[model samples]
Target chain A: MKQKIIIAFSVVLLLFAIFLIARDLFHSSHSMTDASCCGDDFTSAKQVDSTLIGYKRIRIIETGLKNLTGIAVNEKGDIFACGNMQVSIFDAAGTKTKTFNVDSVPGCIALSGNDLYLGSGSHVIHYDTIGRKLAVWKPYNNEGYIASLAVNGKYIYAADALNKRVLKYSPDGLLLQDIGKKDSITGAPGFVLPSLYFDIAFGSFNDLWVANTGRLQIENYTSNGHFQSSWGSSSFDNSGFGGCCNPAHFAILPDGGFVTYEKGIDKIKVFDPTGQFLSIVAAAGSFKGNSDFQLGNNHLVKDIAIGINGSIYVLDAYNQINVFRKKNL
Target chain B: MRSKTQIYILVLIISLLTLNLPAIQRFPRPEFEGKYQIPATQVTNIQPAILQYLDIAVLIACMSLISWFIVKRRWRKGVFWMSLFSLLYFGFYRKGCICPVGSLQNVTMALFNHAYKIPLTAVAFFTIPLGFTLFFGRTFCAGVCPLGAIQDFFAIRPVSLKPWIRYLLGLIPIVYLGLALLYAATGTDFIVCRYDPFVEIFRHNGSYFMFFIGGALLLTGIFIARPYCRFLCPYGVLLNLVSRFSKNHVSIAPGACISCKLCENACPYDAIDKPTGLSVKNDNRELIKKLIIYCLVTPLLVIICGWTISKYSGEFAQVNFKVRLANELMTIERKGEPVTPATEITTFRSSGKPVENLYREAASIVDRFYAGSWIMGGFIGLILGITLARLTIYKYRKEYLVNKGNCLSCARCLEYCPVK
Candidate 1:
């Protein structure tokens, strides 16, 4: 009798197990067939041609380097691109010149004369133009993520995205001051860096231009880190920056205009010095399926560098450098 | 034995019929113009931390009850009820997160990565079970572990496997433990949690392939008897080692055995050891020579195993997503093809991370795997040598005894013992 009861109990348990297995198999097969039905929907939703008027693609230079992070153009038109663990320098004619390895993955680069500064991890490494290591700067706080770099004649500024502040260092690699603190008295609203896209550039008048990404605006500060003025608006249209954080990266054009790259919509636009909306340089259609701008966080091709002759160099997410010139030029 | 065989056949027929019912039933179909949609408002309210504390308390209570039922009352029914409660609370209600089995990886990751903060509950889940097993001989496995509970319920009409086959198959859990620890320590992957078979059933959503695997395991458990616990559970390997040194363990008989041999075949797990007579008639000198030879060859076995596994370090490193992505990018670059970046590549490029740096980091991880795999292989070889040596040595016993390492403290043998 006990053995019979055990048999009945085992049969019930076995039946339940089999039921769950069959149901799961049915659901999986149904989902697999359903997924195929939506295959056409995926291809048909390709981004349309939304190219901003005025700029023309002059040349597309294949850098051959994957995961390019930062790009900077010097006065000599020498382009330096920072990627994974090494930085590659190219001449104006798009010829590779020098390549040297850094200790850590280089994040951003800034070149002043023959001195090149590369943000590798927490430290800003200074190297000579010929790829010789010159000086290693002091580690920014242990937790800081140095995402962008900008340099002038006297000081080098590192946009520490993780700390949400900018560390200003003297030419000799001495810590000078921390900027962009949330101080109501100084009226510094602070830099809002939700992700690691904080970028900085030195303007024509030596003003520090910082991409306050989270607020969807660019703020200018004096050489000594005083809050100056800011301009930008959040909009999904072509007139303003949009998405979770607009203008993920920016560079100062020679004419004091701003070349800004918005991540989610993957558009590169030009703004006047007063932050007035200018013409579009590159549109979302140009990037096509290359950008990842889903939801709030956009991780697309970043960093814009303006060449000496006014040619705009944009690094796509895959590290391919796209050079855009004025249409009539 | 005749009735047991008859019951097994009867149960098998019923189960097969139950499985065939879906194919036999034909219902009138209802047509729809478009896909059927069920509007599900998924309001995911994060459960409070205090509730997690309550779960810890319940786990403690279950373990205590299981220990009492096994050691004092010698009641298998009590253990089964406690196991059912564990399956409901930990498996169904808690969705099997923070389980001691998965907590092994968290504890391992915390030991290696300083930045990783193991939650207090995870530490509690990990240590408490091992602590209980040290004194009570796997009361946690007998009742409190949801993974074990779910499997134990399906284990009926289990046939005893050959001793040699059991010994060989038993080596798998050690290998699994080695691989899990290697992956966790090197920050490669949490293979245990990622490949947890039954977690999908508990959570009600997972990979389709994993669901099939889970169902297949439960089906196998019907005849194999706790297949996951005996062969695949890395934490069970730890418990097996800890239970060996346990001060108290479940005994087959409540008092005297009387050498009746009735309870000899009672344990489906083959944990009951038949009594060996007072003396052995084997040649002692030959046995001593074989033991010495085995001891000398053990290190050589370790070296060969370590070297062989280390050769496949590159393949093992593929378990890491970064290493795999870096390898893919490198392969594309080498092929001189136009790169179409995937989502991971796009994310990597947008983060301004360096490709050379990624490659270098991946190479370093591959090196770590080379060393880790060597350690894993050597550890397995050592375990094999020790198991072999123990099996060779014979021990004298007055009566039948429960194998401390294999007995789950379910107390099934207790009912068959006439003295009890």
Candidate 2:
């Protein structure tokens, strides 16, 4: 009798426990968190406060974007992000206006005036603000990606990182000067491992900030091809850029300050004119699948655009643009 | 007989594993319309799952071979060698998925989670071992599965419970089935997948605690006799019940048996049952009563259990948090006002911890505790149900006992008669 009673109690308990587990699973599988309730959280990226407050999170909205490589912003607070095969235009309101699709992916985008200069494999394209291909310029050998491009008064500087040289061209696509050569490290002041020199921007003193990716530092050069000082390394957390390669893509701020973004760590940090570490404007937040229809590819945060109006726009993988305007800009 | 059978079964399974099946690298000719084009199988790829199943196969083959050696050659005794081989085999090479426990886990998961990625191990273990169960009896379960193998080692020094207790313990598989389904649907850890001791033996190069647990089970298997097969495995229950109705049935078959009762004691799996010749008279009415009770109880269990599990289904995490989130991150961070890339603004962001495994992590402690107590509980219910059925059939047994009148004139009685 005692044995039977024990069995009876156990059977009831087992049945009950089984009940709870079954109930829990059924509830979890079908229900979704309300976006409005998950507001400011990643599930709800549309929760906008009227007040421009602290920046929080980034929500990825789409997937299947092929190689969203590099990003850049334009003057109208629009973003011109590119891949080797295409260029994406995202409007101020975070929607794609148009896409410039090419046979080969466009790697970098630098906006000037009302035009967007896009670097495709071995060629550079000049596109109108509305994303029409105006003209295409190909290098002589055209081997690999045209990694970086910068424009100053009809002078277009193209870094043939694969070719180990910067090809200077006129606005009409005329090749003017091909500086540096294949495998030549140009023993300039702070040159290191050279492959594809990634970024070249006309900085404070007509000093071009050459983000030498392989060397893991930013090299500065005079507009006339003279070498200047260099700052940064593959270390970034504690004043020095972290990692083994491509440390600095410093976007110079209007207040004589600078903001730098790291690719591997996925963070944007701020620095002063003297390279002193400032506040981290955005921390490494959670990434969801395919949020940006504008950010073209995964590896292209180095291509960003800051308008004079203090609005910052980022082109993500697959031509999606993440536009950030200052609270009081 | 044992050594010969073990050797035969081992050779068969090993040959089958290496046989001309659909080689993963060699893409099969398309059979279906509109199926996703199979990617050209990469030559360098050794799927993590294939290696895991092979580990189970190797463990089974090796255990049988060692068993053959121990019983015939007397090189060793007990399940020490089996436990050692499983641990070392799983440790040095295919860390843990090498056990059939994982496949059982998948079977449980499949019944609930439709989108579940069925590990090839599950299919292989199921089709092969289960085929053997239907044909040659539970030889696949007898010693091959590392869990069974380990338990076979431990059948020593058990606190022998009553047969009624043992019979009751056997009903645990049903409860496991229900719980496993709930978890799989809830997107919880495939509990059988996650914490199985034998699979754990194969995973992570053999943790200290796993060796202890595995060694304990094997030593216990020496005395307790197929404990996991008896009470724990839901798949075993499925295959066991199916094996009963299998075309190639296992029985004494009246003539083949010499009425020696040798195979009954020799059978480590306890699958051998006595013929209905000798003990037909004592209890007939009890069987009818138990049948009626079970008929009442089973429908109630099905309805009540199903209803109760469906009630609390809301709390389970919807996302399989372990899914590689590279794509997930990109979509969430897109749209509207982009946050500035100032690294200093450290806000509490959701870590890429997959939510699918979340509920399992929460329920693990409660689940494990409940699993133990429930097994005991289910066993008791089964005993009472069986006892009640025996009460209903008592009157019929008295008439059937006199001169074997209810027995068919078949020679099935000759096997059990010592007088023969």
Candidate 3:
């Protein structure tokens, strides 16, 4: 009787302990829902203050191009949307004006006077407005990814996302120097492009503005490739950029404001000349049904361009260019 | 008599094959995005390189002390106190990492993957115990191994199980050893470390399910006495084989056994073997017939098991992370649903890598599993055959002796010896 009681007690103890283990495992595996793991945090961040939205989308131009890479605007108010091995030009009224085929898919496009420059893979091809190839610049290296191109009166700065540096080249395909290299003497903090989202544009003062996306800041450099100043902050709020690498694409406004497109949070924000929190042009909630449509590769804003009328033309993931105008306050 | 051995071998093979089947289907874990962080339950202190060397030094010191206590001193109190210290230092202080039991996976991984550089500390931790076991039996298990020490501490009312129960459970560690090696060699996972119930208890933080498992095992240890060491530990299989050939081993009596049978009842782990008198009239012809039948059946069993396990090799390969990810992607594509923003899938897409590359990698790993499963299955079959054959052979003895392979050299039976 004594032996049987001891054996019975041991069995019960082990069974009770095993019951606790099984309950925990089963409950944990079953109880996890969309909101439990991560949805609450993401949904909460997507909630933007309606009053902070300073711009209303007036036009959404449906470009039937697949895999749209970037958008650029010229002084003539012509919008050049590049993707799917072709460049489509649109008038300020969102009418398709002209289309031209490139030898390869262009990562970015820039305009200087009447000439159009396309960063097709490593090679940069110069084209006239009429679609005639002017010159093809050989790749600085085979592994270079010329993600963004900025044109000044004297130099063309290409943001090489693969090389993590800005390539300063002459218009005629001459490699002048490399900018944004980590240097203590020049105080350049180098380019920290975690993903292929590095962008460059010329500011109003002729200083080259580069998006240091990994550091969540837009840095200003001299035309001769010297570090100047940068502006941006990392936060979950509407005024700041959030994600692994934000400000994926940025364009200078006609009034010297900054139009920045951030991924992950999928927000288009604007800032003053000195990087003051200005207003939100668009948030993730502005998309279809206010749902996080990160599925189907539609989570990113793709690219942004500033028109001559200060209209913000956004190349969204759905292959549509959304045109936003300032709301009448 | 022949049928008994045959039945035991067949039972073992069938049980192992059934247990090795594919896991049940369940919901996939949801991937979180944005700035969400997993709640911090415990902060793991990363050990420095110098501290890892110190761990190795402490392991050597404990093993030496336990061997002396068992052999030279024959003091159970010394062994118990030293193991308690090992439980504190190696278990609680070091957080139970870099142990010899877990290092078996590292050694297996290095052997198969040429790119993998096995750490010098892991190589030492894995080999030093085997060397000590060959010379001084399983003194390491008595006081050095924290996993064994923790279980030993919890064995308050150790019960000796029946012989058939012991035999059935003994096959588990061998099978576990085979599966652990197969997974490690294929770069699947270090299952030994992943499922170690006591490691979480030592760390005071981990998955809640694992915490309950640790508690359950400890509760079970109160009756079974170091249940994991006897039935679950893959590393114990290696020590058991090496200790069988040890030059010096723990003995119950100092000089001669008077057949009091007190030490037999005192051994909680059932490591003591009673002497069997010689049979005057031997049945040589019957024994020869049984031996002949076993020889013919052993090779046939190996081939059968190899073919059986290889049939389900693809299912087993599902445990591999790369293979599972490929399957998930293929499922999503087949369903024609929009690719959800699951973290793994999105990360793959943003990396600009082609989907075809992932499919090809998963296929290659599955193909490797097919070949590996055959060898693993055949090895398990051979172990069963050997186990059954050993039961048939009897050695003549007139005195009680310690079963070297089964003994942990803990010296608990030393006090029960009337002659001493």
Candidate 4:
């Protein structure tokens, strides 16, 4: 009988505790709905900016491209975009010209003369301008991803973001030297990639430029794999690179400047040869529905390219290439 | 009749052979002519909301049935079958997500963080077992909990541990509960779910080390009888307290006590308490004096324990990612090291959040740990004092009694009762 009394008292106490918890849970569920009253409807780019800062929206080309990973333009102004296990060629006017099916999805594409280089899976494949396969480069020890590709007169550079190293290869696909390994003797600080946004571009003098995204710096390396200098700043403001890694995609302008595209705050900015922030071609607000996208692949720059006439083409998260030209001020 | 040694060898041989059967059956793969494409597999078929409701309903039903079998029907076989059903439905089918043990963290998080909303199912999962235990004594542990049920299946050829060792190891659950609650309340990590030994086995895909740990625990369970539940499960610490105040618990005998001592060695978990031969007239005065002294000294014990644990509050706070990242960045800065920042550090810097703000937040978390550890230590001290007091005092009994706090309510002792 005494045991029963103790148990009854404890049961009442537990019941009261349960009642309090239930009430709080009920209130939380209702309050959560009220807090997110504005559903996830994204603000469109048209609504955010009537004029996309010093650039006119010349074209909104619609391509049936999914996972549009890489975009490049050749001397002939032909635009090449690779994704969805295929490489597509578009004329200067955004008309699809030809498509070549590939075995694996290419992470990046680079154009030299008439030869198109593709960083697909762990191997680089070369093809003629007319889509005929040329040579399959010997497979390199790619850790997991081949994130970016760059081609110069004598060498091809593949940025292996997974291994956090850049591989310089001969035109015939023989691995030459591994760049970006931390070496005190060479005074190279190596690459701080963080996420898969390692981009490499060839300068006019055949110098190599790699984006050490984690450090928010673009590193300049000599053709012989020597670190020259690096410049960028980690800041939330307009002048600096922001997020874990940014300038996810960038193309070399004709005059040796860089047209860089950033994720998280989806924007396009131009930098001069000396790595100074030149001007904002497009602000983050110019892209619709990207404000809430977090810093990752889902919100990363899919691809970027520059036409011969200095038009900036940006393949955004939505797979639409927005061509921006200089506005007549 | 077979000897105990012979039975042990036989069971070991059978278990070993069962474990080795997979290696023995090596089949060749069939060749296909056309190109083969693997079908895309959906991770989960059921909607999470609907599945949560179903899980709660099943938990309530299983708890009631387990209590009925152990207390009213006194059927060990019935309880065993129910446990098997629980292992199938809650363990394999549900993939071990909406579990009461892990839900303890969710409840703690909700209580501490007003902005954090816990699913209604998680609250029910946490509270229902406690409510049931207050009335019926750990019916959830008996069969409803899939973790317990899976271990119970392997609890064959069990060995009894020494009372001193059992008491010493019993302190681990209280400490684990404290750390789990501390981490959860501060939004650091869910240590319970992360370290759950049996969940890997249920899911069939998890960290490789966890799989080995699960296998090792199952091997230990073959001899130790629900080792995780006795020594590690933080939720078990909560259940043990509620069960002590249970209104009705399983008794060894259904009718009159014959004192035949048949159930003395029956319990594999060593939950049976022997009768105390002390009479009220002899040891009453000395026992009362000692109990009063222990009660008076318990507060001092609490303060001492709290101080000792608080000294390591900074170390404990490192379990949070932000605190850890800040510490790493500070270390790198102090050393002037040229090492590349990790992904987490890069993300933090890229997000443009103020580094000083991160340091301040880490300091505040350390403060929370200091206070939480003190309360946890004080709690353990109180339990220790109560345990000592209970042991020194005497209770008059003629028959074997189940230790309410320790009993799993598995109903195994019911079969040994002669008066039934």
Q: How close is each model in CA RMSD to the real structure?
A: 12.7, 15.0, 11.7, 18.9
lDDT, candidates in the order shown = 0.75, 0.49, 0.77, 0.74
Report interface Cα RMSD per prediction. 13.2, 18.2, 8.9, 21.5
Q: For model 4, how big is the iRMS in angstroms? A: 21.5
Tens-place lDDT digits, model 2, residues A84-152 = 477666665556677767656667777778877877778888877766778988674758567778876
User: Which 10-residue window in model 3 chain B sums to the lowest lDDT?
Assistant: B24-33
Clashing residue pair totals per candidate (backbone < 3 A): 6, 128, 0, 1
Clashing pairs in 4: A243-B350
The DockQ of each candidate is 0.04, 0.06, 0.12, 0.02
Q: Could you tell me how far off, in angstroms, the CA of residue B331 lies in candidate 3 after the best superposition?
A: 2.6
- Which candidate should be chosen as best, given lDDT against the real structure? 3
- Model 3 chain B, TM? 0.88
For residues B1-420, could you state the per-residue lDDT of candidate 3 as single tens digits? 523533453354235324524655221112235545544245455678898788788888888888889898999888877876887787777778879999999999999999999988899999999999999999999988889888776676788777886787787788678778988999998878877888877665677667767777777888888877887789999999999999988778888789888887777788888888667226557666777777778888888888887887777777777877787678778875442345455545544568999999999999989988899889877877777666556566678899899998888889888896
* Cα error, candidate 1, residue B418 (Å): 1.3
Residue lDDT tens for model 4, B338-404: 3223435544653456899989988888888889888888887887888787876777876799999
- Looking at model 1, residue B405 earns an lDDT score of 91
* Winner of 1 and 4 under lDDT: 1
Best TM-score goes to which candidate? 3
The digit string of per-residue lDDT tens for model 4 on A1-329 reads 65445434433432343344324323322222122211111112112232335566678778777667778888777788888888888888889999888777787898888888888877788887777887877665744468888888778898888878888889888888888988888778877765788888888788999988877778899988899988777654546675447667778887888887765455667888888777666653334333321222223357788877788887765566778777773
Report how closely model 2 matches the true complex, as a DockQ value: 0.06
**Which stretches in model 3 have alpha-carbon errors above 4 Å?**
A1-329, B1-48, B277-288, B338-341
